[model samples]
Target: MSSSPATRRMSASQRIIVDITDWNRFLFAGKPISGVHRITLGLLRAWKKLGLPFEIIRHDPETNRHKIISHRFIEEDFSEPIHIGGGRIEYSYNKYVQRRTRYFTELAKAKLRRFVKKKEVVHEDFIEGNYEPQADDLLYFCGAGWDAPETMHAAHKWKAQHPGFRFVVLVHDFIPLINKVYRNRLGTRQFRRWFRDAARSADEFICISDNTQADFMLHWRRCGGQGVPRCRVVTNPHEFLSVSDTRNQPMSNGELSAETFLANRNRRYLLTVGTLSSHKNLERLLSAWNTLNFFRDPEADLVIVGDNDPRDVRSLSPIRRNVFLFQKPPDDILKLLYMNAFCSIFPSLYEGWGLPVGESLWFGKVCLCSKSSSIPEVGQDMCPYFDPYSTEEILLALTNALFEKDYIPSYEKRIDRGRMKSWATYGSEIHTALLKMT
Candidate 1:
């Protein structure tokens, strides 16, 4: 026998289309590719490996016009135009905004136009009843948000028109749930509406963690939007490590290996990795570390690996001289740091899913994480947990994880758990889920 088939069989399957917005880049100027993108690419690769025929479609907003450009990745062709209004003019007025917007917008629109013009035009608007889906085609929307209500409405309409086709949506975060308190300029009503519509329309909702899925469910119930699509928890997959490649390549930006950096600096220190944002609670971590005398040793360093936010710097003046802040290091260096660090400290106020906790465990690093949100889920008992709200609690945890000579529980359990949850295992789970969906 070949194997057991898990995915549900469709009545008349034509082709699978995996769609995403901003598929080219990862989380908010962090990297061209990242954890989510890696999983997406991995899924595509897995489909190909299994000989599953599918097409990848990416819809990017056109900078100059009120439209969106769609490309068919499998055919290397572009499809019909999707009219989505652009907000370039309004965005350009903000002086603090990065200048790369114009360049990126123009480049995306040009590339999309060229690709579409070269391919057979499908001018039918699935959203506006310009075209109807055939029994064979299925559309999977990944990392889509409520910000585009029209897209969701269109997908729902198309699904209704073609009952045989599958339409799935992947929810990356419950942003409104945790970020509602920080609604300064972004209208709270608008954000809530987007979340409501997304929960209502999606056929299948893919959540990055069980905690996220539960949060969505709770919010949906509270909003009286029951009977939403089935929410499934799928842990994001990390790139499989190649021992040889990691060994051969320079870990840092060719500056210094994390091991070497730590060796020269000091043996005792608490490390944190993330962009310097309010949610990260970096200042609190620093205050706690200072109070505990965790880094009293003159050589000890509290190294942070991420870009510092100017807003945060302004709010918390007199930046500590001992706190070494480096612009985001490359992945290899990060992995090396996790492998060698005395302890990894993450005191985020909230997280949809704590990636660093899982990552630190994967590298066998003792991690000190906050009990808030999904951090506990990611860290479990493998990490030494702390109350993010209490400076004293965090300080105590930090002190023990760093100075205790026999602090081996966290490290041992991290290695054990990391070994159990490899990328291959994550891929297998996804493969099974996709198969079941079919």
Candidate 2:
């Protein structure tokens, strides 16, 4: 995908326009940052730091239009500290309030269906102005876009209006499309529609890993997509979050300090970071721990840190006493967890790029990971791996990692941090690739 020197430079009037509609939606809903969001934020930060010429735009679904967004606006929002209920009682009370709100909302919805005429929920547009596209500008969606049909429609419209404009979509994974079990009927249908629309609208595509690129091509052919667009693989940064990042700020009074939290645990805990989604294979990992009777050890524990789903929590009910779950932990606490953990584990059955594996390895920790999909691309031979499908293999791997005295030390010694690319490097490479495409 290399371009000749002549076409690698951007003209004075040209600029890259980043679409962060997904990020805005998530922020409005008070959602926790996911891996994809982190990747987008990292790139944005890198580009800003390196003085890359770029403008930010967000597609307003309510207005069915795009608007210019300032980088400072997003940066300030990220800089604000997160407030999660810290104490056990406060956390319990917050959970109670959430449950009550959900229950009443559902009840009201049921009543309204029976007694009231249904009407469309109107939304007020808060964005100041609509974005007018420049012919030479590169329009890119770096954040999640599968759920934004309106945004995709707008992108398609713009591409048609401005023939010289290039619209690029970043494909994270084909999980909902490839694996039916991970999503419901409605979710699967939505994803199918999104992929078709996104692929149809884009002039070019970017995949997080080589495996993801292969998956994209396979599905593109299956769907009978037209002439292939220029696609590239730009693996995400492996570096961990630094203190300068917004998430590393001090917690509020209600939240537990990492040092105090670890002191309370008073045990060497193994860390696993990721949402308890079906694709994460948490059940298999838990089974491996159970089979080894590792939970019976008083001095050892398992720390599960990630956003939690009610259905997933129900499915994995009656969690072991030694298995402590920290739902939606702040980044600072998470960093300390990684720092103090005995080791880390990533048992995801599939991923575009197993970020937790890279994060674990970044801290010089041995990450017992699944040898599936794009996971191996993140850790390679630096960490041990096991088949996510087989409980026997998971058990064996866990046993070896726990029992072997030199297991963690051996991996730490070989961690070659020099090989890991920083976020600035990742952004620069992507910027260069975009320039070449133009």
Candidate 3:
């Protein structure tokens, strides 16, 4: 018996190129803000640490083409042109004028899809004709969503034409459709279709979590799809280091310690950090917090540090009295908050990997997360769990966590656990996974 061609090809040094269509300046044109952006930055840092010979190809809106900005030493390169819709503008804004402008821009861009497709064809032809004279050169497609259809198509075409190359798709999450919270977005359907196509076409699939891999398998089965690539769950890495020097660090930028923020000199407070979105189940958390009488106790303040989604801004009005929501804060301040807080509460209804769960644990702070999606896989037993749907259960859990005087874990135990789960270890795991793929 012998292994298949795919298995044989995996054992070699290869030049890898990752396509990031929705990253960095592209996602945040005006300001550097967004969870995805921050996460992407962390991943890039980790990739650099791995010392892999790879390049990042990003879509440039001005040129309507993918350009390699990071690694430029390669001789043969193909720039894929991507067709983007104006729907983002409409989805992001609500005013009539803004909507009209967005609609028109989208319509115009939609009409230019054929042109973009042609440019991609030309680029592929140039690569095939000029560069890939040898057969061993491999190209890997890495990304989650359907935002880069052109690059995906190019990868597929190149793989078919140059049978030696390998293509891999990165699966982030399958909740955009299955989860009712985000069903309204038309782009979700487009992304799903693209994901299916890319998954089927790729030589392998890289899943961010085991939960995501299971969800993707279920999705593929539901759609009567077959021949999907083998998937390997590789958790995203958090490369941020703990600040060694927190002495005299100013927490005065509206970012206060858990003790001061709670307005109680003696009692502990619960904390949650993430965007204020419907899927986050903040309303339920707030309802539970209110029931626990956190505000009156003067010892418990539910400090939320993240920007609020404009659509859900009004939903937060009723809970505004007790909940302290900071739009944005520096990473140092956030790290300090995580360290000082009694516990970090993450009641998200769904998540791809639940970065905060690991992050909180990394800081030696206990986490209270819902036993839903990928949270349990990340939190384990170190952090308490709660049923996200049941407000009463959440309330009970919070009360026990805060009011019970003897419920605290030993400080030495926490430090021991935190030492075992640092970002360096995470980065090493990811590096090993990439090496296996090569």
Cα-based lDDT for every prediction: 0.57, 0.71, 0.58
RMSD values for the candidates in order, in angstroms, are 8.2, 8.1, 8.3
Q: Which pairs clash in model 3?
A: none
State every prediction's TM-score relative to the real structure. 0.71, 0.82, 0.74
Ranking the candidates on TM-score from highest down gives 2, 3, 1
Model 2 agreement with the true structure over 12-65: per-residue lDDT tens digits: 988899887666545544555557777877888888887777887775433335
After superposition, the stretches of candidate 3 with alpha carbons farther than 4 Å from their true spots are: 1-13, 24-28, 31-33, 71-144, 238-268, 294-298, 309-321, 410-415, 418-422
Candidate 2: stretches off by over 4 Å:
1-7, 77-128, 242-259, 294-299, 309-319
- How many clashes does the backbone of model 2 have? 2
Residue-wise C-alpha lDDT for candidate 1, range 1-438, written one tens digit per residue: 022343554344456666544342232222334444445555665565555555654433333211222232322111111222221111111111223586467556666775776753332322111223555566666553433444555667767787766666666666555663243334345456656666566667777777778887878776557665577987664333321122333334235555467567645556787765557788788787566554464345677776675345435534455565544445555666667766688898877777777777676776788988778777777777888888889878866765676775635654565333555555456556655675
| Deviation in Å, model 2, residue 383 alpha carbon | 0.7
- Predicted candidate 3 versus true structure: per-residue lDDT over 1-438, tens digit per residue: 111122122335465656665542333343433454445444455556555455566544433445555332121111111122222211112112234678467646754764675653333311222123124444444444455555666677767776667776767777676656554465556656676676556777778789998988888766546765488886764334431223243333245543345344344556687775667888788788776674455366577776665336435445454556644445665676777788888988888878777777777777888999888777666767889889988887788777776555742154345334444455455445555665
Model 3, position 426: C-alpha lDDT score: 54
Top-down lDDT ranking: 2, 3, 1
- Candidate 1 off by > 4 Å: 1-14, 24-42, 45-53, 60-133, 144-153, 179-191, 222-229, 237-268, 293-295, 310-321, 409-414, 417-419
